[model samples]
Target: MDVLSYLATPFTDPLMLVAVALGTLAGVYVGAIPGLTGTMAVSLLVSLTFGWSTNVALAAMIGVYIGAVFGGSRSAILLNIPGAPAAVATGFDGYPLAQKGKAAQALGITTTMSCVGGIFGVLCLAFLTPLVSKISLNFSPVDYFLLGVMGLMMIGALGGGSMVKGLMGACVGVLLGRVGMDNMSGVVRFTFGSTSLMAGVPSVVAMIGLYGFSEALMQLKSRDFTVVKQDVKRIVPQFKEVVKHFWLTLRCSTIGMVVGALPGAGGTVAALLAYDHARRTTKNPEVPFGEGAIEGLVAPESSNNAAVGGAFIPMLTLGVPGDAITAIIMSALIVHGMQPGPLLMQNSKDLFYIVVSLCLIANILLLPFGLTGIRLFAKFVEIPKGRLFPIIVILAVTGAYVTNNLTIHIGWMLLFGFLGYLLKKFKYPASPLVLGIVLGNMLETNMRNGLVAFKGVGGFIGSIFTRPITFILFLVLFYFAVSRMRWWKAMMSKIKGFFKGLFTKKKA
Candidate 1:
């Protein structure tokens, strides 16, 4: 359908527009806070939209989805706190810029890049989902397992300062993810017989604790702090700056979409992966990553926004939830009596198009609101940590508790909170742990499926060598492992050698 036709549809009713605006606004604020997530925003909206039309409800939900993901960069840049899991990578450089008194510029630049990434992802979904979905069909169980291994290794390589700590943290995450039921046997593995344990630890609660509560705890540790000073002039980012970083923005957007399209890989993974890619691909590796590189902000901000669009492709084409936000979206669709599969496309073409169209609209709307909001949001840096941390602690507790309304889940969050803080203290990247948890089930499921397809262990092993994709994935895994081990030493030696050569040349 044409834009004009879509505009004339019932989905474009004033009530729907109002809903979209309100939800988007709410999403930005919720996501700006360090604990509330896009999933939570959508989950909350689900209750309020029972009486609304399907398109209206979807428009509202999508608005929140788009806004919340983009909103995460606000805290990431301003407070050194990642407002959401996806924004974790943003803190690598975002906080540094805040300390440098360029928080406004960083926020504005990140917001613009995020909008570009979101729009690019939507375009990809509009045009390339069929092809992307087809590529996913080629992934065998071995390939998926290898992919998980590679993803985990990438996190290990780039996570904090110590590889061992990062790996341990990642292992902890995998163990936590393994707590509920065995994939093939349907037997409970780690659950100690409590009925609540049967359902397993909630990913949201874990994420809130790891990314949210941990941040609050860390802030509480520092009684004396300096607030980020903002300059309004910097908040209105220059067009030239955007053009200069166009390539980085594009690359991160592609990374986000590709990662997000994968089932179970969400914005958090996408952001971290993009950050790793940015670090590797940059010409000057000396730009101290944790010291506030614009590249850091650009990487996560762009990728997370792009992830939203990437997430919808699987939901629309394969009936799979691309991420937790899309999972909520799937539930919302079911609530509206609209099933979400190939049949939905054939039966409700307009509804599908309406969603795709909303993505485009939401991307456009995010820019002005995002820029204006950042200008005002920089003011929050003035809030004292004593007051701010308490508010953050409450929000974190509330967000974690609401997941299942169980105190045990809150306790699980606290456990992860301490774990996350210690990991951070020891220079371990907590992101790898998150990646492991998200991909662990896929790894196990795919391996079982592939083994069953092969009819035996021998055939399964043989297929690894025979399947070209599987072989390629293995090669990538091997490369990542060896390369990660040598990266730091190699880079340091290279720097040392460069200086020696420069001195030798001068002496000659």
Candidate 2:
């Protein structure tokens, strides 16, 4: 009964409804523009909404979150430019569909499946958040340190093509994250005796620079400004096809949710995994995997959308973010004088329900609004980089200054923006760096606290073997670390070949 009332509040509040609607409407267009991402949009929102009421602020942010994620697919299908990383897989078949004069059909199908996946994720968050929260209540500082370790390992190993490069970027981020006053010792760190450094490097500024400004810089390098025009007809997909893919959509959504729950592996990985699942399971694909298979579209579209819900669970319950956007959201909550974790669940159940309700409403709105602006959005995606990048630069500079109204922060933004551009040029993954920065403080504080509690370094090290939870986390961390080693993968490959040869000999 209590949950029912909490869920009903969003619908009853006219202001909340309008905020969500407007945010989602804006998000759809923003996300369609290449180089703009949900994380970037949310970061900008945090600055603008810092002075607003909590519920209204959250409603607007949540609407943008849902809309931006879905909006990425528009550019992917029409221009072969994935608006965000999560839509990379979508472009594989999406662009092909556009070339085949079925862009409208592809857009409709993706919209439907994205909604299906998103709702499925929300349901999982509702049911699993409490369960995860209960388990997190038992976590000690040692366990948290190990969790941070695992997060870094996963981000490095799975975030990019080169694990070494990913880990290097993450290490740099962790070091940068340490540039503030240490809470435990009351000693300044990495400040170079500058008073301004006492407040440390603002994560908000880093986000604005790295993702927002650097992204604009990266996009400006491409000289091809050609836009392919598509004649979009049939904004609705065939009912029979949707019915036929229903089970596959559910399965992919499940994949997405599970991946999204794990820190560092978000929608991109979920979509890839789901796309691979579809290829392996479909006994007969109407078209081969790469060249416009409708199944390809269904798997990635559904899974990535569903991953959004899964991404929020860890953030709301455990205070660990599932991805960069969630990390920004976590920062927003912190700025609003709220902590997200087990305590958040116990003290602010209403807020939790409100977020869930907003997600549901945004997804419902996604279908109609996403479907309605087909032709206009298709043109919107083609807005030339020449005109677009200047506005983005202006927004980035403004967003940085808004963080604390400090001119120095804008310089911080430019510095990080240049560094981010270098990372992009070298193909280094930016996500691991962001994750490293976010987790560094948590990892250091917990390790120090745990050492003091255990009475010494030896006992702190021993705690991993003594505590059941800590021991399990240690093992998981170990596995993630070892799996990234080239030697281990090679050894596993050899072992597999030996077994296969043995089986063949026996059959002969």
Candidate 3:
């Protein structure tokens, strides 16, 4: 359906509009808060929405989905804290811009670009999903394996200053990922006989430590953050500047949507992949990518929002919950006496229509709410580091403790936090390690499953080579690895030459 057609259908529906507005507002607020996230917000709302009509529930859900993604930029730009994991890269550049007394302008730029990114994602969801879903259906074990490998390559890209540090970090993450019972043998790998370890280290706790606590410590070490009061003028983004990065924004949106559609992947992965993709594609990448790259802000915000739509594609059509949020939606469907999947589409067309309509409407409603909230949200940067760090530490502890309501998880978080601090000191990129931990079990189990399904190692390799998609993915990864190696050598050579030249000049 056309954009106008989509909106016109809902023009007379006051309740739908209300649901949309409320959802968007909730998303923005949930996303702007330091520890609150889009996933948590939607999950929390699932219970509340159970009694509402599908349209109402979905409108609120989708609205929060968009708002939370956008809300992440608030903390990212202002406090150097990403409201959501997707906004991690955004903080790198967004906070830097805020520090430069361009808080209002940065907020304006982020909100505007985020709006564009959201629209871009919505378009992809509306148009490309059918075609892409068909392609994804063809993904085999080898293709998935290659995809996992490529995803890990993001560590190299994200850990820009040091490959050694990045690889070490990734190794740590991989080792962490290897914890818990083996998928094939059912034998516990790294649990050390602890019942909690049997389930494995929670990625959320690791994420909290890696991004939250580690960041809190770093902030504590720095001198007090100078909160500059800037005139909050022209909160709207410059259309011309957005136009300049149109291609980049489009690419990021595509990345977000595609990554989001994947069954288990979420915004954090999409954001990281988009950030790496942007870094690889750009000629002169923004200097402070992790510290603050406007493009980083743009990529993840677009991708995560798009991912929401992408997740729905599978949930509505295939009966698969793509992520934690969709899982809740699936439960909501059960609670409402409507099953989600192919049958739901066929048997309950109106409900399906409402859900799809809500997603599109949520994207539409995001622009105004996001743009208007920029000024107030940007003020988050003004909070003293002293206040922010303690709060972060407390939240980190609470978030970790709440996992099992056990003090052990809190201890685990502290241990990881200390390790994170050490990794930071040594220039190791902790994210790749986290990704490895997250994906390791999947990689191992899937590989073993593929092997068993094929009946042997030879059969697995033969199947991989025979499958076009799998073969292509393998080749792509190979080429990327080689290219990265070459790039690393070139950078090392330049560094060596500069140092050598300086020594020679001194001797003369």
Candidate 4:
């Protein structure tokens, strides 16, 4: 089939249009609800669409995948709870913005940026699939280790009051992450003779407790429950606002697509990396990062959605699933008798274009679906804090329980919730802790692998200098270090003062 035929496949078929629209709508709600991830939704749809035509089935799945990824930011913005792991960074500033009565603005900005990011990813998938795949091949274990270290270094950015407190929280998180059996060795490290502990603490459960449950606990202390009334008129962002952040959007989208194309690194990792990049690179924001900066909202929303497109590059070009959702989608394709390897494009070029076209349609449809539900969804924030807190508590508990269907997980959730409460009470930042949990395994596993490959600590250090990419990453680490140092700031200030004096003398 030609390009026109490939593009028209979804738009021309009545069933395909309905499937895409309905699937996108359902995906938004699925993503807004905790524990109902896009992967789960796609998995269920696979069985339902088993007998359907390949084009129709793919259209629905693509719609859901796009909608669900965008939907996650809604809850993260309106509430402290991140519906999905990818939205965790969104919550850092989104919740703060909501508390200040700009929930509508945050939602609008996130929606617009998410659409932009999704489009960028699709464009990359359509035009640069091979080049992206080649770049993805360069990430060895050492590279991943450096990436995780880079993520961990965000402690300085996220640390609210004191760097020491943030480091402490992150250290605790790393210790918590080490609770399970060693991935390389069979011996358990911190199970303490408990069967449930052997599997380790689930990061999702900890996230719900740290963010959702703890926020509820904090609300319980306050008697006044006045809800912030959202301004319905300003629910959609203006064109100028989108243009102002255009460059940041592009940069974050690139980060999202690149990270997403890497096997095993999904939207969660992509979003975090993008958020850190924004925090580091932005010169001056209207507000501090943790205090509702638009940059924070723009970066994660764009990157995570862009990752949806990046994820397809490997699956279509290399037969490698970029992430879990793509893995499920790949399974659905295989069920329909389509192989997703390098030969996939050569044999079924139309299928490749069809997938790309579906993603485009889904992302376009996302704006209408995501924006229209704001009034109704924003009402949740208007409910009395007492009532809302209980509902949030129920959702948090249910989300934790659903993770493994084990009561022990609930215990862990409550324990972490209380710990989170204590940390918040003491003004310690919780984000770095969550970051530690998320990147802990990646950091540990890769460091060990790098050590083994290079024959020890000294060789591992030397090996980084030998590789170009690793060496570049080392330079980035140095920049981060310099950026955070007081001496660097003082030196820059002196230089600026010297320039000011010289300019004044010249003018006089």
Candidate 5:
């Protein structure tokens, strides 16, 4: 069949249309609940759909994937709890926006931006798959290491008020991340002889503890819970507001797509990087970040959804899984007797187009499904603190414990909850600590691999200059470091003053 026919399949077939819609609706609810991830839902569907026609199975799975990714931000906005790992950065600003009585607005913005990013990614998948896959392939260990370091540098921006305190929080996170056994040397680093510690602290546990449980504990101090009245009429954003953030949405979507294409570096990494990018690049946000910056909500939401589309490129064209969920999808394709490598397009070109068509349909459907219950979802923010805190604590503990089915994980959650509370009490930012935990292993693993590849520290450093991409990344890193320094800021100020004086003289 031709491309037009393939595209029309999902729209024309009644069963296919119903399947996609139902899958998307299921995905949204699954993703909105903490601990019930899209991966789990997709995996379960793979088994149930094993006997179905290829078109029907693919449509359902893609719909769920798209919806679940967008759904994660729902809980992040309503509660401080991230519904999925990718939504962790979303909670940073989303919850604060809820506090300001803009929960509905935040949800609306997220839905709109997510659709834009998803469509952008699908376009890239359709038109630029080969180029993007090639670029994804060229990312060396050194490049990844530099990327992690770049993410770490965002601690300065996320520090809120004190860079020193941010750095300290990051150090603590790094230490906690080191609790797992060493993957390279087979030596247990900080397990301290506990079998549970040998496996390391789960980041999800830490996330729920730090953000959800800690927030609950903090709220316990207050007896009154002021219900913020949400303006349902304002749920859908104005056209002017969309136009204002057009460039930011585009930029973050690009970041999401690129980051998503790299193997194993899924939406979580993409969202974090995009969040930092927005933080550093946006000249003036409408509100301060970590408080309720709309830019903050836009960047991560768009990027993570864009990553979903980017993730499919490598899987369809090269037989490589872009992320864990894509891996499952690829496996399902194999079980259906379709091979997924370079030959996939030659043999099963229709399948490729079908997947693309399903993704497009699903993303478009996401709007109505996502926006329908905004007022109902926003009501979660209005519950009394005395009543809500206990419920949050229960959810937090349950979410943390189910991660590994270990009580020790629950202990870790409580410990981190207390630590997060203390950090907040002392005016330290919790975000950088989470960032450190998320990137610490990636940073360490790549740095070690780069050292091994180059034979020594000096050689590893020199190798970055020899490669085109690595060299460019190094230059970007250098600029990032210098631009944040006091000297550079002062020099730029002087240059601006000199230009102003020159203009004044001309006027005189």
Candidate 6:
């Protein structure tokens, strides 16, 4: 009857404990493979568990949700392929570390940090749900628009030092994303009378082609077929390493939790925001970002896992779901004759706490399950190039097709793959392009909504200054935009040098 008893319920029941453990285990592998998203996995599990007891069904789904989120990092580290959209930022530095024979180290950190973030999120869910949920309800269209712009500005961080090229790549991606019918207006934009294009570009397929298929293509051009042995000697990470990045992990986890609590804004947005924050806040990472920076791994991994807990804040506290996965989960609760929201706490007290405890348990389970696969997962890099490229290409094709069961998607994959290869040849960053597509819809939709609410472009622009949240976001956006400029850096350098010279003369 007490909260402690409810929290301990899962651990007390052997059936529930085993269900959570097995679900976690299955989720890890499912999420590691491209095209098998957590949304799909959780949705499938929900249907199968419709006839099962409520407790076991809830435990199983919760475990899979946590495991899949963490599992996405596995592919990001090993193959430069992010198994889920949330892992997109993870692959930025993960694959680079893998190339340097540190895949094990990367995996270990992601696993441990995921646990830290997961627990932190669950704690927040337990104590701060009311406060967090209230804040989420206050987000206006202008605020969402600003959030999208903030995400887009990460192109500066992702551009590999070429802002112009990054902008160009992002613009191209925005066009690609526009191919589908407009969600608000319901009018087709660029389908060109082709029904297949009606669905627009699939982000997962794009990722598979850009990172996976294109990476394989780029490697083949080198004409080298030798397999390189990755060092698996130090698979387990050191405690000091975890301690060193704990501050960063905590900060990103905070970002994840807050962003996850917002409706329609999920871990993808949270992960990107955390990555940009890490880029700006981390003065001097041991390695530069996009080149195996440990901070890169710590930021996104921790934030995304933390988001899993944050997502529950709204789903349980209000009838509103935070993201697609949470929406499915809310529906599952409905199927069991349990409605979520304010009444959930008073009515289904045991069920609510059981979900919370399972999330905590699943994340803790991430450690052993995550680490055990390192030696085996690292072997991916050791496969001969001649053989590996074909496998990657095959997987990319399969994953792309499996997304919507449409052959045309495979054609789109090849086109994106070609585009990605050309971008690589030109030294342009493919990630900015991907980010453009990922944030394009959110940015466009919110901008349009804000415009309609304000009734004109002038009003929409004016609305930025009319509100506290928008003004703050505008200031942050301006800072990011200006700080990354070459002229700004040059001017700052000159000013600093002049001051240094003046100080030196005075000291003498």
**Candidate 6 global TM-score:** 0.95
For residues 1-508, what per-residue lDDT tens digits would candidate 2 score against the true structure? 9999999987888888998998888888777775567888999999998997777788889889888888888767765545666776687688677756677778889999998888898888888876644554566878767766655554543355677887888888889988989878999999999988888887656755776677678867877755545556667777898899999999999988876776666787677667766865786888876578899889988999888888888898888888888899888888888788868878988878888898888888888878978866555444566765676677677667865788888888888888888998988866566656666776898889899988889999999999998898788767766765889989988999999999999999
Total backbone collisions, model 3: 10
**lDDT tens per residue, model 3, 464-495:** 67888878777877776876787876986799
Which lDDT tens digits does candidate 4 get at residues 8-94? 888889999899999998998888887677888998899999999998999899989998898888888887888888999999899
Q: Give the TM-score of candidate 5.
A: 0.95
Residue-pair clash count for candidate 5: 0
Model 5 agreement with the true structure over 1-508: per-residue lDDT tens digits: 4988977888888889899999998888788877667887899899999999878898889988998998889989988888888998888889999988899999999999988888888888888888998887888889889988877787877888677888899888988988978888888988777787898987878888888888888877767777676666688888999899989999999989988888767798889889988988888988988899999999999999999999998898888999889999999989999888888888998888888888988888888898878888888777777777888888888878777688888889889999999989988888788888888888889999999988989979998889999999899888878888899999999999999999999999
Better of 3 and 4 by lDDT: 4
TM-score of each: 0.84, 0.63, 0.86, 0.95, 0.95, 0.95
Q: Which lDDT values do the candidates have, in the order given? A: 0.77, 0.78, 0.72, 0.88, 0.87, 0.88
Would you list the clashing residue pairs of candidate 6? none
The global Cα lDDT (0 to 1) of model 4 is 0.88
When 3 and 4 are scored with TM-score, the better candidate is: 4
Model 2 residue 5 CA deviation in Å: 8.3
Worst 10 residues of 3 by lDDT: 2-11
Lowest summed lDDT across 10 adjacent residues in model 5 is found at: 224-233
Which candidate, 1 or 5, has the higher lDDT? 5
Best by lDDT: 6
Question: Candidate 3: where are CA atoms >4 Å away?
Answer: 1-9, 76-81, 98-106, 181-186, 222-234, 286-288, 402-404, 487-508
Model 2 sits at a Cα RMSD from the real structure of 7.2
